[model samples]
Target: MFEQIKVFFMKIWNELIITIIVGFFIRSLKKSKELVKPTINELLNNIDYNSKNWKEEIDKVLEIKTTVERHFPEYKDYLLIQYGSSVIPDNKLPSDYDFIVLLLGYPIEGNRYMHNKGTISDESNETNKDQVDIVFRDYLSFLFAASAGMPYENSVIYNGKLVKGHQGYFQWLKNITKNILFDKDFLIRRFKEKIIAEKQEFHKCLKECEEFGHDEYYVIRAGYYYITSILQLRRIQNFEKVITQNQVIELSKVRSFYEDILDDNIRNKYEQLVENLKRNNTLDLISIDDIKEVLLYIGEEYDKNK
Candidate 1:
């Protein structure tokens, strides 16, 4: 009886010990995961936008901003204004957000330069990578981009917030944006240069896509150039005012104004391509042959007009 009692107690103790060990292990694992995750404030405060290359900079900004806006809703108030597809209300698609941001009391007084404070990553959702570009600028840098006739400045002047605050600083930025963007000669020269650049980019992306396989990256870029070239060509031809990408797509869908000049088949293709780009965030579904043919048509039209 004594021996049996001892064995029973020993068995109970063994099971208890095993349970305690497993519990401890799980607790440690939970702690480690908590430590690995970054705080919301840390993520928001760490955005870096110092790249001089506008294309590369915008790419990074969009990737970072998507995560920021979804995870943190408070930051939307801080957003000055959004350009691009977000400016369109009825056109609901998973489009990138291109906007300006105001981060108060940053970079410090003496060390007041666009330097990063920390870093952020989106390990949670790897598949659907929503991207939007955010520009964090001080007064002088904003003025510089406005005065310098950079391509993106046109978007801001048209869509960005035009309010007065911080000692009428916002108004100052607005005035500068208008002064530079609205000049007749400046628009003419800028549109002409933009046309050439877009053509080159469209061909370059198309060639790479053909040489390499049909990659989503190259297709997206090609689609961008394709639509932008059409819009710029129309603008230059008619001496029309500036319009956003969404505006151009809208006009194309109805075969209105400049878009009415497109061949019925070309107009249909343009409509299909733009819709696919908007819905899937890529031009993967569109056929390469179709793309080439449409591009050829666009080139012919441009040549005739030019």
Candidate 2:
């Protein structure tokens, strides 16, 4: 009789422990959801351009240009291509100056060569939020990349405006940009490369999502790139110039096509993820499996098209 009583009590104790553990897990999930709610709300509603400091921001960019010119006088013939949020009109909190310093009269070193001069930040003012990213490349290399339909070049060069450069260099860049769209072979090769690169990035994001418990940012980023890649491929097929990368404008341009191409459920999930991310600063609610599914779908589509 005592043995039977002991066995019954032990079983009850084990069951109670499991119930407590399950309760804690559910509570943790709920707590994480709550924590992310406020950030999402703020992201969705904050549309202020904060353009009152435009002159100040321009001054900062010019200062950085002067400093870069002074330091790299040997490359004084470089073209300064300005891009990113700072260049976009009505961009909220445009905080950084992005530059691609293309050195004219330099030879291409083995296809292409790139060197990055890390970001510079102001130390004098506590509230100074200005930053500069200076990327150096030979002019020939830049032209080649643009002509070859390199994904990075497609996104950057097409959107960039010459902030400070010689008239001749600007004209050359403009002509080359137009001519590259006609190179069918180059566009085909570039499309293939983009597919490989995006697939690799998707896998890396999937791994990170599994380990970090947050797939929202990765999913949104992957979805954007996937859609962008598809648009580029379609443009190549139709002999159209790839569109410029104004996130709001460009995304909208491809939205209808993207919606038609992607599975309905995947499309809806991606849209929701983007909406959530735009409002929230943190990644909290997401499913890794969903991200993987979308990525796989994108890859399959690319394969079929290629």
Candidate 3:
């Protein structure tokens, strides 16, 4: 009788112990999920830098470092950087928030999932509130870009602000960028590609404008690209270092400095375009032909130089 009682108690004890262990495991998993829950994930799609709420939107974007770190702790050396209009105010509403999460080491298989998780849904995202663009790149790719003197990589080296990561890593990036051996062929090809792409987009916008009423948004964007391509071509032609976006845009407005690049005919047209785009939200005063002429001039100049 005593043996039977002992066996029954032992079974009960075993079951009780298992129940305790399972309960503890469940509680731990729930706690972990809570602990790693991203604070920015909920707010990620709500960031906006419109004229009314730019200040608040900027504040929210600045907090992305913590979330990135928590989610991507596997890679110790990474840079979370902000560039483009998000960092530099160009007196117009930014098309989107640009960010680069540069992993400063070898790529890992797990990084695929990490990248997917942080990828912004900009294409299908109808609302400008979540118009975030994230470019995830590994060290090898970044190094190659720096070596080849790619414009965006160069801009990050020179103008990008570090939202998170070691200062040493960013400094190392700058150091490599300083000694970059620019690939002339690569640059020429890039310039050609940009000119063609912009020309197509500009013409498409013009067509849209003709079909619809006035598309100030796309027209302004085409102007922005035209100015950017012009500036980049100037750098390539002169073998000068690349400048910041704001500096390039500002310089484009001042035709006096670019007398050598812009002939009398092109300069007059460019000046009118710049004046209209800079002063107001409307494009009534600027002639569509002016944009076409400026683009043609740049394309001819690029061909000659290349």
Candidate 4:
């Protein structure tokens, strides 16, 4: 009877030990998940552009402003603006941000100097990989580009929150943006430049693919560029401003046109390539020629419609 009692207690003790171990593991897992996943506010607040960490860079730019004003007194009035993905309303988790120093007066030498020397080269090299971009723009060129429905039209002028600059200048830019109207000639010019640029980049990506192995990511990117380029051209031809973000909404229509009218496998290949890229970061499934063919088809179709 004593032996039986000892065995039963031993079994109970063993089960209790196992239960404690499992409970500890579960608690640890929950804690790990909590640590790994950040809240939306935390993610946004931690962005490099908004973070206090980039204050040094911002201060450097401000110092540069002093140097610029001293050297080129004519360009004393200027506005430094931050825009791009960082300022988009719905873009809560932007990869990085873009800053533009807009000069009101035409101080060519000072503008060039700032454009060439405004950045920390080493930091920019690393930050480029992280998606940070900075540029210098004269007010006239900025106005022209904004009127032409350039991609930067979608960006917001930073309102003294992250970077320190003239609030009056920032407000001026906002007002100008609000009042700017689309210019057809500039839109056409921008469209041509866009097409040429995308084509050149596509060719470069193809060359890299041939030299190295095929990269699914580049292939998918090239496909998207081609589609968007075509859409932009069509819009320009119709005297409409290019709608940049609605591609996914129009994907089915584009696919149907390619499949039924064009009777080409480019759409299927593009879809598959995108799916493969999403599933696996590294894929060698697509060919350079495949992208070239699709681009060629798009070009031909654009010409036909134009």
- The Cα local distance difference test for each model comes to 0.51, 0.54, 0.59, 0.53
Model 1, which residues run further than 4 Å from truth?
1-81, 84-152, 161-172, 179-186, 212-214, 240-258, 280-282
The digit string of per-residue lDDT tens for model 2 on 86-183 reads 57877875344456667655333532332321222232122221233355666776666665655455456667777556868767766766534335
Q: How close is candidate 4 to the true structure, as a TM-score?
A: 0.47
- Determine which window of 10 residues in candidate 2 has minimal summed lDDT: 121-130
Which regions of candidate 4 deviate over 4 angstroms?
A: 27-144, 151-170, 213-215, 240-294, 303-306
The C-alpha RMSD in Å for every predicted model, in order, reads: 10.7, 15.0, 16.8, 9.8
Better of 3 and 4 by lDDT: 3
As a TM-score, model 3 comes out at 0.45
Candidate 3 local distance difference test against the native: 0.59
For model 3, what is the alpha-carbon lDDT of residue 50?
A: 53
Displacement of the residue 296 alpha carbon in candidate 4, Å: 3.2
Give the TM-score of each candidate: 0.49, 0.49, 0.45, 0.47
User: What's the lDDT for candidate 1?
Assistant: 0.51
Model 3 per-residue lDDT at 137: 64
Q: Candidate 2: how large is its RMSD?
A: 15.0
Error of 4 at 298 (Å): 1.7
Ordered list by lDDT, greatest first: 3, 2, 4, 1
